[model samples]
Target chain A: MRAFAHTPFGALSIAILRGFVRDRAALFFAVVFPLMFLVLFGALLSNQDQSEIDMITVGDVPLLEDLPADAREAFETTFEVEESDDLDAALAEVRDGDADVVVEQKGDTLVAHYTQTEQVKAAITQSTLKAYVDGANIAASGQPARFGFAAERVEDESLTTIQFFTPGLLGWAIATSAALGAAATLQGWRQTKLLRRLQLAPVSTGTVVGARVAVTIAIALGQTAIFLGLGAATLGLKLTGSWWMSIPLVVVGTLCFMAIGLLAGAIAKSTEGAVNMANFFVLPMAFLSGSFFPLDATPPWLQRVSDVLPLKHLNEGMLDVLVRGQGPSAALVPLTILAAFAVVVTLLAARLFRWDTA
Target chain B: MTAIAAKGLTKRYGDLTAVDALDLTVAAGEFVGVLGPNGAGKTTLLEMLEGLRKPDAGEVSVLGEPAWPRNRALQPRIGVQLQASAFFERLTAREQIHTFAALYRAPGSAADEWLERVGLVAKADTRVEDLSGGQAQRLSIACALVHDPELVFLDEPTAALDPQARRNLWDLLADINDSGRTVVLTTHHMDEAETLCDRVAIVDHGRLLQHDTPAALVAAHAGGGNLEDVFLALTGREYRA
Candidate 1:
């Protein structure tokens, strides 16, 4: 027990944490930078309502359309299209804001107009028009009749930007704090030959690495808590999952990122080079893992790229608990991936680390 | 009993040989100094003996156990002051020493006492980064000696100190030696090697050029002048980086 207490890992961890607190620059980069990013990303994601538009069907247009029997039956059940022949009048109604959108037909052309110049509205109108044109084409070709497009009003839950960004911010905070705290500190220790000294002591390397991982996890959790508290109090964001679920995810994510940091520190020959390596890995994870914005708009191949990032799974797990109010079981895939990442990186770091100045 | 024994020890880094094949032994309770010029492999030999580095081809035994990776039981029995051992910048000198002291199974609780012993009591609470070069060196010594090991390895311990501080450190080291602990140190200062070491090994270009008492070496090679003249005769006046 006495020997265990003096293990290099725990002592180094405590020492590193104390050093971080005393260093104003490190404290700013480790603690404050992520908070600032959270604020920025939160502000940007605040307007969810603007991304969805209301679909207001005008009137019965079935009587005007030369619909096939099967098409007419499907259209009658799905839509309440207006019968107004005055397409200009209906478009004017949309232009006047009385309706969010208006759809009409004019000599083999389907024209859809929106009241507001919203990207969501434009997308919905274009898709609906395409469906109508395709239906008309099928009917003219005397093929089996298909239903015309029917716009359904998607009543999306209006979430503030901060609420939408909270999960991503949490992931970013965990990654930044864990990676910078462990990797950068290790590099500095190596540069000064402190690690070589410690290696000569009665301490094991496992103990040293374990202690650093523990401290990094603690710091990461503190970062997560700060973001959660400020997001809730200041931005009205809420974490819907239980503490038992969220806390474990935080721990797993911290371990995964800390391992990556250790590997980076071990492989980098100098402090300057370590800094460059950390930025090289962490920046890509941040941007591509949907920390700042939704990756849903990106292509399928890009989404596949995000799947390999630990931050992506971290964010997904956080969203599951915070947004979907799911349990730990609901996050098994992400949790497993994070654990796997931690194990692999830890092994790599341990294998690559050099105690002496090479 | 022999506290340290090395046979045909050699270490090489690529094309450069850091520690050439060498045979050395230190009896228990003896104070030995390894004297050499820059790049003479004095530090490298010390590292291998201290179990911080493995010899490419050699057998090293410290307290009857192999020296590379060091037997855990033998660790508490040996203390090492590396050529550039560093402390956490934010930790007070006392904290740093106490932390190291705790590593031993039966360490003293009087960290401040060790600091005072090293002439750092006034700066016990000062962070390591705030200490002067001499003060930091003293603190490093205090850390090494805190556990009161049976054998101590000091490498370049007085390299960057003022004359007064260096003298004080020498007296402290002598006191430690008088207490019946073996001291293995490396230094380039001929006067220090002459005054403090019971036996001296002069090495150059990774090989042992001479091994005997400072008096005996001078009598043999310096025409009875001094260890410096003996050293110059063996290593020559050429500068090495």
Candidate 2:
């Protein structure tokens, strides 16, 4: 740590950090508020299940008459099971959309015919059936498996709801805090004439802004630690492949958001106005970017809009590394897009920036 | 040596001219006050001279260097005091001055001494927000002068203060002026200008009406009247400040 006893950048950064630390509202908004969202969303969505699939049994499906009663119960919860002696009737029911899938035991193999009208339901039905069979095969051989109540693929790992929300909500928190904090702080300084005082000093605008950015990045690191720590410790957030990769992703995200904030501050006429403007943009962007909801269930138009949102890319990048078990290369496109976003906004902010109030 | 020299200074926001083509000069070691009513462009003129706001058409040289485009070399050589609200968000009186001193890379020892000089030693740990109006104003002055600049600029340091508070600030300014650093202040308070300024520049409608010693300005304009009457004589109206 550079002591406050020397250097222009050090002094300015220390003062900014101290000011932020001392401000109760900022601390709550930046750190505590996000944690609350994590606990709320994490708990609410932790046990959320995929929609049940409808299935009809037409023949002696011995796999369904499983030796383990718990695995069978698990399948029942995921698929509404029905029995039919006639194949034509079962196939007609699936075709008529009464059932999503029709499973029949033909000689030695279990065959499943599913409807295409509801693609997601059909896909889940097929996968869940396969996982049950796979788990049964392993269980018969007497290998320890935790797939007692839930169908788990023997070879592949899947993302859970808690894992998904950790980064999504955390990303939302970082974006809002960095952007709002920058806008309010800058606009406040301008209103109070602190901006002019800084202009009079030997310090350059670059130094002042750079200090602010550095401090935000530091706080972002802390946010990541606390968010991830709480998520892991209490919410059962499993740290998967290259979870450390989120470090760089978060830094870039903070930069982009801070640039947006600086631009908002420069354009707004008052501190209160800047805060309103920041929230006006950040809140809707959070939902659109899939931070609060999953994008797969959204309309095509919403997905298309999210394609251009910076937070979307940030959330995608974080999901890729933190939960999807991706490597360092997974963050490349997001890094570039966010960096470009930051540069463009920084330039725009510079154009509108005034050392004194309008 | 001339501390500040400006020529053809002008600033305009759209069709409204805030500061007309104005020229002024101040010798090194003189306490000068720019006196005017509110919105008379005194702030615009001082900001342009301080290298904070760019003039639409003008040139400002401070401490023998171009102040426009911001003379980086001359930054530490001068100080600018802002309003009390400009202090860092929740800084104590001592921390505020220390931060400013550090920005200019001045000696840390000067920060504490300034708090004492401004009579804020007992309130050194008090956050600026909690300070009384006058104490906050004094702390603002201490922040500007923490680096011991050769020249200092203050923008309405005593506005909104009680009479006793205002007098305290005036006495503080007098102490700083006694140290022989060039001081330039902008104020609508006529008595403040007349009492503390060695020379007073009366401006109205963005034009300089008079710039002279307080005694000379009073003698040359109103004859038997004070500085307020001098403004009345210049504008044919009551001086609101």
Candidate 3:
């Protein structure tokens, strides 16, 4: 006389899925916000120096000529410093995107004009010219040029900030969405007495928890696809590793965050408390895990601390596969750390879950 | 045979004991009502028997088997309607009930049948959040019964219902009882107990004061007044809210 004709897990998942899809706000945050971040960061970092700043010298700029032949050759190789005698035409070329900066010499001063909107290029050009002038004056004063260093990248291909940031953004988006989403959802279920009611059914708690975790992982997979697809399509994102390696990394990261969310739900007594607790855990991790900037920019001690966090592992592992083009084996350390965190937190969540509000 | 029997059930929360040494027995095919004021541990007691909570002390048997956490065999044999059960917010009433029904492995298309039984067939396609309180209550009841268990537990099923909705639920419960299923419900409404229950158990301060046929309890404790007077006489008039 039972009312159901099949296993409840599928039906239960379908019902729960409708809730996620119908929640327009959650959908927007889970899907659109990450892509939005990608687009915004891509636009900001698009024209950043992939190789070197391009400049044009006009009116026999002595600052450009005063360099030693080898130094001049290196400068021309590092920076596209082309010579043009016509000052007005050089300015026109700079305005028309033929050059990043236009420089001229008048008396003892070296005058430089740059595109107003190209602040990064303008700053680098100004600093480079100033350094050359300082070096020339030192050599003229009967002293070896005091300071000069050539900038070279260790990697074969130069990378933009966006390339470094995309993996972090991907990790952040998936982790926050899965963790906060699970916490809020489970707490709400407990608040409404749904968990209690669910306990009365024939299904085991493991079955229910498994269904939820599976659904979250599935959603996280979709999140990965959207971010990677959008990043590669529009942002010139290149994946050198077995790009498919990101799949396992995202899956493990999803489990890790979901387990953390389950722990939050276990501790929180109410829906609001669950959401607040999730944000409390996730927001700080997002900022510290190099989601918005390079980890190298952070203090050495702070980076060391971040290296132990799950989010940092996720971000770094993803960066290895996506940006660094390293295979899965290259990210073994971080992947193992994330897997361990997932196993530990999932065990804790199972031990502490409260089906009833009491 | 007894459908449910609890021996010296006890539950304590920190310094507060919600249910203290409570004993109860329910027979097969009977309609029983647990009557108590607010905070009388009625929910705690029912939850323990429903296997949703564990009593610090005591043993319980439902359908001749131990009823405790993870009593898998006993689960599908009982149905429960919580006071404020929430459904998936976006699921239509039918889909919500079907989801619950699916858990019990009930026959196909059971949700529509239960929705019809609860007089909610008209709202079957509506999302749970869009339903009125009464409609939602009916939907909750329908979901509880969608599995068609031999025993049913309903906690304050008619608390927020309008008079007409309350009457409809009374009729439904009476019908279920008539069909040879045991029904246990807790309520503050004495009139509901007088009209619907075959037996009423009065409780206060986490202890049972009386359990008997409603009419017999009235005749014995009412001093010639009605059943409500009997309830008031045994359980006092202090606001337990």
Candidate 4:
């Protein structure tokens, strides 16, 4: 009798796994699709030049005048510098896409403001200005060549653009795959009356739901392995710090997204609507969460919004373990948030689930 | 012993009464049919009895066990083939039944036997979506019976089958009944109930008009005509269904 009870759950998981393996759409989203993203973003962001300057100077900016004659001539030739009297208007110009960079001098300190409109150009200006500042500092110090400090990266610091985005892209892919996979599968079962069929067996709704969640998490783990493997082999991704801790985070993150997907399935009346609804919530969350791109330079309000999203925590948690060289302690808060989100959303989904279609 | 006993079974969908104060009972090993047209609440009533839907006010017991609140104890004892159930996607017929058999912890050999019993051995390797409608229905029935439950419920099992396929299914159902496993089936086809059921329950407008053996029902209600004419006389309308 005990055997009778256990087999069904195992069978359900196996059956769901088989169905998922055969589902080309899910395979494309979870594996092939994310691989394409890893390649596309890796190539595009790595080759970008972070040196050309695009700046808007407001009021008296002494940094430009302090540059040596030869360096000032090279700086003036490489960048387009615009002068503005209204600091507020100059900042707005950067915000509104009318301009690329704004260098606001606050007494002795220099503040650079830029927009994501031309993210590549703005990034170049910020780094290039830092280089110019370092040069000026060295010249003023009057130090001999022997006394000058040489720079070296700390042992655990990230080495390249690919390393940072390896986790970022992995986060996005798993989020898409887990959320869309659960929603589509649930809605499809409802539409086809397979849910009703399962109800006839000697299994509780909790058992079926538990099995489904397990299978999704398993697939997500496989996805993480592939992303990490391919990222390291081809994209120069380095795994450091508490990187293995990402395994547990992957499981928890998958639960959170799968819960969201279940909510979409329960709310939408049709399969297509559920898929669209999952996408509607997940796509925006991906960008705000910094899955495809870093949100560090984004405005304060945008970062606050990112804080409210579960995907942000998933990405950020994995980033902490994988690249930031943080310990298991770093994952504690994000894991808690994700687990809590999973519980709340799953309850809501159960409340909204309709048996009529099933 | 009674296989099922349901009393005052009432289910309401807002303003509509899907099943209203219905009473029904099935003796062990008896083949009973619930005959009604589309929108006549046959499927709704069947679902309530199968424990898939909650009743507004009623009591239902399958194999002397409460069917509501989804009694897990009774689940293995009963098999249900829903009106529109689907197979696991992309699975071959053999794999589908094997999966269902595993759910019940039945041996894989039993799954194969059921495939042959349903005459799907030749098409066992075909993917479910590639099977014809009749083959799909037969595979569904085989999957339902793979565990050899004591009782079975089939809803509209032959609704859209061609004449030949329908005839073939009738034989399969007859075999199931001959093996002493009680069967409860709902259908709109008058002849289906009259020919295959030991007792037929005529229903309309969420009410049970009659329940008796076909010969007895005809003699007692219409005194002469076939089941359709008997339906026409009972409800004062042509039995289009």
Q: Model 2, which residues run further than 4 Å from truth?
A: A1-5, A48-156, B238-241
- Candidate 4 per-residue lDDT, tens place, A21-40, comes to 98888789889987898898
Candidate 2 per-residue C-alpha lDDT over B81-129 given as tens digits, one digit per residue, 9 for 90 to 100: 8788887888888888888998899877898898888899999999989
* Per-model fnat list: 0.59, 0.86, 0.86, 0.70
Off by over 4 Å in 3: A1-5, A50-158
Query: What would the per-residue lDDT of candidate 3 be over residues A256-351, giving only the tens digit for each residue?
Result: 998888889889988889878987888899899988888887899999899778999999888888888787686777778999999999899889
> Where does candidate 3 clash, by residue pair?
A2-B106, A3-B106, A4-B105, A4-B106, A241-A325
DockQ for all candidate structures vs. native: 0.36, 0.65, 0.59, 0.48
Clashes of each: 8, 0, 5, 0
* TM-score of each predicted structure versus truth: 0.80, 0.83, 0.85, 0.82
Q: What does chain B score (TM) in every candidate?
A: 0.96, 0.95, 0.97, 0.95
Worst 10 residues of 4 chain A by lDDT: A150-159
lDDT of each: 0.79, 0.87, 0.85, 0.85
Positional deviation of residue A57's Cα in model 2 after best superposition, in angstroms: 26
Top candidate on lDDT is 2
TM-score for chain B in model 4: 0.95
Give the per-residue Cα lDDT of candidate 2 at A339: 95
For residue A170, model 2's alpha carbon misses the true position, in angstroms, by 0.8
Identify the runs in model 4 with alpha carbons over 4 angstroms from their true place.
A1-6, A48-159, B236-241
